[model samples]
Target: MAKSKFLAAASHDLRQPMQSLFFVFTALERHVGTDAGQALLERLGQGLGALKDLLDSLLDVSKLDAGAIVPELADVPIGPLIDETAACFAPAAAAKGLRLLRDAACDVAVRSDRTLLGRIIRNLMENAIRYTEAGEVRIRCRPAADGVRVEIADTGIGIPPEHLDRIWEEFHQIGNQERDRSQGLGLGLAIVQRLSRLLGHPVEVHSVPGTGSVFSILLPAASRPLGAETRRTGPAADRAGDASGLGRVALAIDDDAIVLMGLRSMLEDRGYEVLAASSGDEAIAALERSGLTPDIVVTDYRLRNGQVGTDCLLRIQEFLGRKVPGVVLTGETGQDIVSEIVALGFGAAHKPITGAEMRAAIERQMARHAGASASPVPEESRVAEPA
Candidate 1:
């Protein structure tokens, strides 16, 4: 079967059984206060974690083959991505009595896909922690040649030299151990390999037979502001900013129910009063029926009737008698479509979106209309920082 078809069918079918099992596990765990029962819950959590890893790896392979994966370059603080990844893996390490340290003291920046870069470092970190039964896992960022080099180093039972080259190959695990068997489908490094290649970067690994291993990814210098660091040291707890502003009603449109629910919850949680619609016609009717003026319209780039987001935005703007800020989200939007989006005065965000990237995109909209007021409530007459 085609990888695309495999993914669509498998993800759909997998979710049903997994979600059902998840609920049952949750219910059973809730009723069991004993340590033995708690062990079952812990094991169940690990199983779910493993299942998610498999799904993500499968999707990564498919995306890479289809050439659907690419870098999203933006001005980002160097410390933030490392910090966020460290925070995510800290609990897992703590559970194993392992120390996680982040030496992200470059006080600099790098131009790269922040999300994908984060994922690469994160996979390395998780794999490091998973393989090691003791000591620490550390992430370090430093200035390299013209860009930056990030290292995820773990003091674990290191890989033998014979196995080093083969490890980054697809589904390859270094050692034949019970621990290695349970942690992943051996796709962590494969993801790192695919992402690095796609982004025109390279990841280098150094490991001793029994001491430790260090994996490094290098990239170019950053171009813009390095604001909003989400390290544990920062005061911006949760750091995921709100999407609401100036009474803008963003239309959340997607055919996938899970994506719809997650995005709607995420947007609403960020304070946007979202109008969810699964189809383009429904999205248009939503605007007409609510008798409400939309401040900004956000829709999935693909709609059910094969209508593109540009088409829907055009129709809605025509109905409103003016152009509104539009943001299109997509799973796979080609380069040509991106040019069209920009030409149509819209912005695009590709999935799966991080809280920070989503906020950044929305802020672009806010910044665009910041000082100018609208009728629903005139845009803030106050001055906004220049883009």
Candidate 2:
């Protein structure tokens, strides 16, 4: 508990600056046209990506330790998942002159949490690409008796037999003795192991030292027939191109001035009319004074004076006398907090959220609000706040 609390606090503090940097860089990228500027931006983006990975790894370990992650299982199509995961790592593989191949010929559905499953596969692929100096990384799916086995094979530096069992231990990196940040913090496999156990999936590894490695995850097959056409959805970044929150008013609440500024700048860049405040009361007061109804609310999870983002959202909605779509931005990785946010039916975007992610969440919430408005009673109207 102590460790979790410390990590949560540290993550929240660290992410504030990171989040601000992301917004600033994104804003800069828009005006940067020269090759030198583009190159510099790419390097900065890579640095930010590394920082995000480290922070994410720490939070993930904490969440697993606290048993914060609850898998939402469903009949997830295999082909689309494989396709999407492969596409995500295509750029990295291409950068290394490696091919990312996906053999999704098996038209099967897996009974697992799609998000968690994707995390596992993505980690494996990243690990594969990171370790492999040459050759290709291939993802192949095959039918098993109880379910399907998805194997991530790579022609990289394989793990030794003696070290295989210990690789899943937190901070255990094979061949990275110098503790190089570029090699990753060695938390990927640990997260994969915990998530797999949580989802009741069996994870297997086969490797020949100095040759290659294959990580396989056995996921139970869904008790449903395969559909002729599988719905394909890309990452939020990819889907955000057409979704704009332009001309929509957004209210942001956060105690941190830097975070509030970043949110304001980023939202404004995306054409959103933004109003920012430091607390729930302030946000409500602003709304009451201006008589402005916000189409969407964005807030930090933890606020001043023992308040929280959810309360701010609810207060704003109550003041507006209507349901408003909300996005809860936070660095907190506690299961209880995340559960509460989800229970409130609000969208969640973790701290240090990329421009694309923030945009996607805003767009998603706007769509939801539009749908709710079309209904007889708005969804938020039915949401009963706790006494």
Q: How does each model score on TM-score?
A: 0.63, 0.87
Candidate 1 lDDT, tens digit per residue, 249-347? 667666666566655655665567788887767877887888776666767776675677777777666666666777787554245667678777788
Candidate 2 weakest ten by summed lDDT: 233-242
Error of 1 at 22 (Å): 13
| Candidate 1 vs. true structure, TM-score | 0.63
Which residue pairs overlap in candidate 2's backbone? none
User: How many residue pairs clash in all the candidates, one count each?
Assistant: 4, 0
Cα lDDT of model 2 by residue, 1-387, tens digit: 897777767876798788878878777776899999899999999999898988988888777777878788778888888888888899999999998888847678878888889999999999999999899899999888888999999999999999999999988998889999988898999999999889999999999998899999998988686665434442543343336567678898888887787778878887878888998878877887777778789998887767888877777666666667899988877677877887877888887888777888877767655645522335544435435
Query: Where does model 2 exceed 4 Å of error?
Result: 1-9, 24-44, 227-242, 374-387
Best by TM-score: 2
Each model's lDDT comes to 0.70, 0.82
List of clashing residue pairs for candidate 1 = 373-378, 373-379, 374-378, 374-379
- Name the regions of candidate 1 deviating beyond 4 angstroms: 1-56, 66-88, 107-116, 141-149, 174-182, 218-278, 295-298, 323-329, 333-372, 375-387
